[model samples]
Each structure stands twice: as C-alpha cells, then as structure tokens.
Target: MAAKATEKTNKRDFLNHLETYLSKRDGVDKLLKISRYATKIIIASSLIPETTGSLIPRLKSFESSVGVSRKAFRLGKFVQDINALRASRWESNHELVLLLIAYGGEGFYYFVEQFIWLTKSGLIDAKHSKLLQRISAWAELIGYVGSVSLKIRDLRKLKDEENCVASTIEISVSRGMAYEEEDEKMKKIKEKKTLKGLSIFQDLADGLMTIADIRDGKGMLSAPNVISSAGLFSAIVSTHKNWISC
Candidate 1:
C-alpha cells in the first residue's frame, strides 16, 4: 500500500512538472512557432496546380466581397489584431471581444476548404461530413486557437514518429552491415530485419508526405475571410472569458 501511494505521488508530480513546463509563455510561443512553420510546409507541398486554380479564384471573390484588399487578405490582419489585444490589458477592449466572435467564422472557412477537398477526393465518409461542417461552424464561432493547438499536437507527434522510424531503420541497417561477414545464415537474418525496418521507414515517409499535403491545403484556405473570422472570435472570447472570471 505504501509503495502504491508513493508511485501515485510520483506520477502526479511528474504530470505537474510537465504541465508547468508546457504552460510557460516561452514554451507556448515556441510551440506556436513550430506549428506555423509546419503549417507553411504542409501548404507548400499540397497546393497542386489544379487545387490552386480552383481555390484561388474563389478566395479572390470572397476578398472582393469583403472589401479587404488582396494584400490585407494575404497578410492575416485578424491574427495580428488579436495578437495586439493579447498584449494589452484585457479590461478595456470590447471591440476585441467582438473580433473574437468573428474569429470563429474565419476558422469555419478554413475547415470548409479542408472538408471540400476531403469530400471531393472521397477521403472523408459521408457520415462524418455533416459533423465536420458543424465543427467548422463552431470553430468559426469560437475562434480560440484551442482546436488549432490540438492539430499542432498531432503534427508534432507525427514528426516525432517519423524521426523515430528513420532512426530505427538506420540502426538496423548499420547492424546488418556490421554482421555481414560473420556467417551466411546470420547475414540473411540481419538482412531480413534491415529490410523490414526500411519498409517501415518508407511507410512513415509516405504518411509525413500526406500530412504536408493537408497542411498546404489548409494554409491556402486561410484567406482573410476565414482568418479574420477566427481571429476576431478568439480575441473576444479570450478577453471576455478572462474579464468575467477575473
């Protein structure tokens, strides 16, 4: 009983330490920076000519309707505005709160573009289609960046797995080669193990490629319409939530 209690205490302490580490302002900033870069890379790889042609024209139409210049649309003004509010004292910003409400709308746009791609490609089933649409609507309404943070966690996990698989492949290959001169039977066993490891590495590489493709599609979809909506929503909700509770 004493041992079990000690183990539980240790686990709680470890979790507390982890939460503290992750919650620090610097840690959050670093995570955000990493996510942004990952998203950029994904966008670059997924933007095929056909996808670009279809999406860009629609994005332009949306921009024109909103009366935001093409340059402002591209520059993510909403994100900038929310970021400014984040730095300011939360007590005095009602406009920022309204912006947060609209931020959710922007996030909806991003999800819509993603859903369109998935639906057209037949990657997502019809059953989940409506659910995704609803989630997108809520995201647009909420605009808190929490959903994006969950996605960032997924991306980071995928990246870490890819690295681990690569390392395993390298280690297996090195061992196989090192033991090649010992005996024919041993060499065959080592070679087989190495080949299996290589196959796993290749599969991981393909999965990473797919992630990159998804990221690209998302970034391109983030025109001012979606981005602004999300930014405004995030600002309002975060500020208001903080204010009411404080």
Candidate 2:
C-alpha cells in the first residue's frame, strides 16, 4: 500500500512538473524544436517507404512551417543575450572572452535569423535568404564553439573541486567527524558536472547542425538524416535542462 502511494505521488509530481515546463516560453520553443526535427527526420529517413510519396511532401511542408514558426517565436531573443552580456561585464577576462563569443555570436545569429524568417515569410526578397542563413550559421557555429569551451573549462574546475571535497570527506570520516556538509557540497558539484556535461553535448550536437548548414549539406556530417538527428538530440538535451529548472 505504501509503495503504491509513493508511486502515485511520483506520478502526480511528474505531471505537475511537466505542466510547469510546458508553460514557459523556452519550454514551448524547445518542444517545437523537437517536433520540427522529428518531422525532418521522418521526411529525410526511409522509414516512410518510397511508395509513400504523398506523405513526404506534406511532412516537408510541416517541417518548413515549424522552422519558420520557431524563428518567429524567437523574435527579439537577442535581447536576452544583450541582458546576459550586460550582467557579465564584471566577470574575469577569461570568462568575458567566452561570454562575448558565446553571447555576442548567438545574439548576432538570432538577429540575422529574423531576416531569414522575413525572407521565408515572403516579407523580403528571396535572393537575400541564402546570405542571411550563411551568416546565421557561422555565428551559431562560433557561439557553440565558445559555449563548449566554456563548459569544458567549468567541468574541469568542478572535477578538481569534487576531488578536494572527496579528500575532505575521507579525512572527516577517518577522524570520526561529521561530513554531512561536505557530502551535500559533493552532491551539488556532481549535479553541476552533470548539467555541464549535458550542455557540452547539446552544444556539440548543435555545432554539427550549424556546420552542416554552412557546408550546404555537402560534407560527411551534412546528410539530411544526420542533421535532423543532431537537431533532435540538441533539442532533447535543452528540453531536459529546461524541464529540470522548471
């Protein structure tokens, strides 16, 4: 009976968390991204046999619409980066370098994406879309590189801290002292390490997609299915992060 009650509580808590996650703008955007990439994967993959020619076009259209809608949803998102940059002005030089590259590059990418969205929406000349997309792709690539670098550096520091905390815990245990505080600290560090690792993975996946975009889908990593898979992976990681925060 207790086990069943615990299971019921867990389910209710999960539902509440999901409700909160889906309520936020970022959560909705990530969900849309997941849907968009999943649709792209279906359109690109052979899961839908050649005999089902009719579904391909429709799926492609849906993917395209979702892509445009995502951009629309992200309209003015560069403002967030602007705010981030402002808040980080007092950080260390090394931190500032990464922050500038990551936030500035992504900010510009988002800015240019607005133009691409306009072009796709027929509000602007189609001739300029390619150039804007190329610029956005490059900016995104740079941002991802900076983000991955920053996360790796942070992970290394976290590892060092974890080691120190472990040694302290060992000493405390040997001396028969209470180490609950150290244990709690270790848990927090491990959680941070996990999140940072996820961030790096997400950034790498996104970087692959950006590279594929810049290369016009002609290289080894530029296969349609590969791009879609990377996009979906990135989206899922981001959604997971957002969900946990929610």
RMSD of every candidate to native, in Å, equals: 20.9, 2.7
lDDT, candidate 1, 1-246, per-residue tens: 999999877664655555764665334333433343333333434453436456545544443333222112223334543554456443335544544443444544454546644653467776776666555444443443333333344455555655565566567687775433334444444544544344333333323332333354265444433443333333333333332222
After superposition, which runs of candidate 2 have C-alpha atoms over 4 Å from their true positions? Answer: 1-15, 89-92
Single out the weakest 10-residue window by summed lDDT for candidate 1.
Answer: 66-75
Instruction: Please report how far candidate 2 places residue 181 from its true position, in Å.
Output: 2.0
The digit string of per-residue lDDT tens for model 2 on 102-132 reads 9999999998989998998999999999999
lDDT of 1: 0.43
Give model 2's TM-score versus the native structure.
Answer: 0.90
Winning candidate number (TM-score): 2
Candidates in order, TM-scores: namely 0.22, 0.90
Candidate 2, which ten residues in sequence have the lowest lDDT sum?
Answer: 45-54
C-alpha lDDT score of every prediction, in listed order: 0.43, 0.89
